[model samples]
Target: MLDKAELGKRIKKVRESKHLTLKNIEAAAGISATHISEIERGKTSPTLGALMKISKALGKDPAHFIEEVELNDVSLVTLEDRIVEKLGSAGTMENLTTSIPGGKLQARFIRLSPGKTLDEHPHTHYGNEAALVLSGKILFTVDGEKYETSQGDAVYYNGLEEHSYENISKKDDATMLWVSTERGVS
Candidate 1:
């Protein structure tokens, strides 16, 4: 069952914790800012599709907002408990951060299949992102500039840029440790 007010509060808390404005979510999720505002205020509920988009825009799973969890001073997510999501033909993403209140940093282990990209096109969101190549080769395109990276190489940039990456090797997969900070409007 869905609790609309609780859902709204969770969404609002996560959004604010990530330093995101309604407009930021709108740009990433393709939902209207007004509608997001209403949802955050508990004046309305988001549809399943809307929720999925909103969750993705927040770099989270929809369950992250809906699941009821207690907050603690120290949070730990064991390897066994970590959540993993498939990126279709691209490969997989394993979230490495604990789901604690006021969390602002997101860490993920991304595996990119050979010659595959995480997204079809370059995308932008607020905040800053950094990645360290752990295996194989990656070709990163940031704001139209191309950067070829190998194992041990690191890349850092503002998330607002049009950024995307692809596994450059046709015979091997590429892996990276990616960390990103949530953004807020001034």
Candidate 2:
């Protein structure tokens, strides 16, 4: 069971959060607006290929959109459980959602430890990014502009700027949730 209902909810939320209309998704995913409507309504199920194409058009991961939620503990994301197996590894991310389930936004949950810095790959995804620091502290570098983040703080920046995160704290762990979406990124 793909949990089309839950997926539909996430899809709807993403669409609304991005301020995108059915026609926008239809244009991006090549899935018909009517079909997308049905999917959002949980009236129809999408095929894997259709789902993948839709995700690509919307700038998200097909896998993240289809995650099964635990009825026992709604806050317990199974994705997080998977990441716990390799807890201490820097750059380990427990994907919170397919980030931008459909449209122009994407989100991820990352855990970083002291002295570990993530990669500096240059990426030009089509959006801006907001990273919410949930715990500990991190040193963030966006196209050479450096900023430090701590619990209760968030960093927002342009997606066009190359960026990476580093755990500069020696005594604590860093947890961050990243949400990104935009009109365009150059």
Candidate 3:
């Protein structure tokens, strides 16, 4: 059965994940905030037209709200289809996890070029972060403190601390599997 409340919840989750409010949806969808509130609260069901408008406002497809999804034990991402992005002079990063609706964790494979840092400066965010060195050596700095790590070494820390890593190897790239809890849509 298609539950109106569950549909509303899904819509609300996506909107919140995107850091949007009812008023934001209102302006983008051309629907009243009060009406959207009613829809989100499951006090009423939105018409297909209104749902379409809301989905568009949230940058989601209408089916995302209404489709029935079977609970799956695993999600897969193939090598060929992996999302890859260059980090400028820092090297490259490859997404290791498939994007799933309401997923909480994200993993990535980071290849840090020799003498390059993961970011130009230290960064901080909410949640937890951990990494396992796959190759070469890295200098991991957190909150002004430094730790030297080599292949097979693992590190975990609170993401609230300012942290960054650099490939200490002068002639080779350093690789690591980085994992963190997702704060929201990035």
Candidate 4:
């Protein structure tokens, strides 16, 4: 069974954290102020679609509303615990090794295969991030500034820069560790 009251509290907390008012959320979600109030006060439950709208209004993932993390019971993760999902050759992605999302933070071990190049995507966020190359070499262009990194080298930036990386060596794959926050403009 769903805990409507708890969910309401979570919703209100997220909204307040983002410094949003009901009027602003209503404008973005097309939901009524009264309805939003009822949901926040635990007087009513929103349908999945309504919840989605509220999450979108807060610039959060819809899944956040239903996520009830019991961190106390979360055990330290081993290699076997990592949930790996291939984003395919489209975008290089690896499983987040941590058992928890680190809340607003994201940590991952990503690999860029040889001869692979990624498209430029701009980032906007509350803070910045750094990337450390573990093995091989990669050419990076951040905010149009070209850079290169070899094993044991690291790159730090605002991450708000439009950036991309390409494996420069055809013989060796590039391995990197990425740490960034999830609260960012995509």
Q: What is the lDDT of residue 31 in candidate 4?
A: 97
Question: Which scores higher on lDDT, 1 or 4?
Answer: 1
- Candidate 4: misplaced stretches above 4 Å? 1-67, 72-75, 90-92, 97-102, 120-126
What's the lDDT for all of these models? 0.88, 0.73, 0.86, 0.75
lDDT tens per residue, model 2, 86-174: 44556577655432223355567777877777654545555788999999888888888889888999999887788878888886778
Order of quality (lDDT): 1, 3, 4, 2
With a 3 Å backbone cut-off (N, CA, C), the pairs that clash in candidate 1 are 19-183, 19-184
**Candidate 4 positional error at 104, Å:** 2.6
C-alpha root-mean-square deviation, each candidate: 12.3, 10.2, 11.2, 9.4
Candidate 4 per-residue lDDT over residues 1-186, each given as its tens digit: 348898898889889988999999999999998999999999999999999899889877766677676222134656777766554562356656343423555677777777777553534555566789898898878788888999988887776677777888887778888777654565
Worst 10 residues of 1 by lDDT: 65-74
Q: Which candidate number would show the highest lDDT if scored against the true structure?
A: 1
lDDT of 1 by residue, 71-100 (tens): 443567788987889999999999888756
TM-score of 2: 0.50
Pairs of residues clashing in candidate 3: none
**For model 4, where is the 10-residue window of minimal lDDT?**
69-78
Off by over 4 Å in 3: 1-73, 184-186
Candidate number with greatest TM-score = 3
Error of 1 at 120 (Å): 1.1
Residue pairs with backbone overlap in model 4: none
**How high is the lDDT of residue 41 in model 1?**
86
